[model samples]
Target: MAEARQLREYVPAEVPESAAPATIEDGDLTGGATDHTVWSCAGNLTAVRSVRARVRDFLARMGHSETVLDDAELAVSELATNALLHSRSGQSGGVMTLFIRSDGTRLRVAVADQGERAGEGGHSREDGDDFGRGKLIVDSCATRSGEYWSEATHVAWFEIEDPRPGLSLADTAL
Candidate 1:
């Protein structure tokens, strides 16, 4: 068998609370535990695959179950793709940032790009296949999803609640 291709690894640095994106509330999901990772990449189509792979690796290392793992990966993929396809961040030399945080019970994924202001209308395809389907996928997979805009960046995020062991979906009101 051929050897597997290794994706470029991103080493997340400890960002100061003040430097954290305004969209992401501090100490909210991590429960005061600052376990998070950040990846910066060119705002291009290829970045979507890289971000998804990184998300999978990160969540797996965090001991997430297979179901949760798949959802998280899909959610991130959709969000990242939206940023590239619809935002200025996808322009040449533009940059997008991916942030992932976990606190044992929950995980949050946020993608920030230097793009159009939130709510100022985003990109859509000519095909009449229901615009904004990305948010739909994110909504179905994540427990919560939202978007935020600052003077310089547009940030979209999703939060997933990891199912507790020995509990079925019917047992929890997620």
Candidate 2:
């Protein structure tokens, strides 16, 4: 399993003291260079890879710098893969959705799935083998405000401030 850096340890400063929060209200929202796009896929694990690939292609086509595209795509993969592996619950119509957004100053990636994973706590790939706690990676890279939720539906997300000329991950690494 790939070692995920610890979230608390890699805290970035850009994360607000309260951690910025947002949502994907519906399925019809259109994303722009400074906005976001939401893509939903079925619970099958295969869909995770597909979502990652599509997101990467989309970012590349959008002309995002390689660094930004890779970070966003990695975050997408970790969240989507986790949704398929743990939150599916074998439900007939389970779906996993990815919300990608960039505010020019930062990028936010969110992954939501059909079932809740609250009681199980967050699982880590280091927890004895088959799965690694991908959230740790997300958290480490995300601003201090990044978070995860396991409500009736499972959702995990993270945010990274855009590392422009005057900004650095360290500056954002609260």
Q: For residues 69-130, could you state the per-residue lDDT of candidate 2 as single tens digits?
A: 66777777787776666765223455555555554555556665656543666556567876
The number of the candidate with the highest lDDT is 1
* TM-score of every prediction relative to native: 0.70, 0.59
C-alpha lDDT of residue 157 in model 1: 80
List ranges where model 1 is wrong by over 4 Å: 1-27, 31-43, 117-121, 124-130, 165-174
Task: Candidate 1: count the clashes.
Answer: 0
Q: For residues 124-162, could you state the per-residue lDDT of candidate 1 as single tens digits?
A: 656565677888899999987777666566678888888
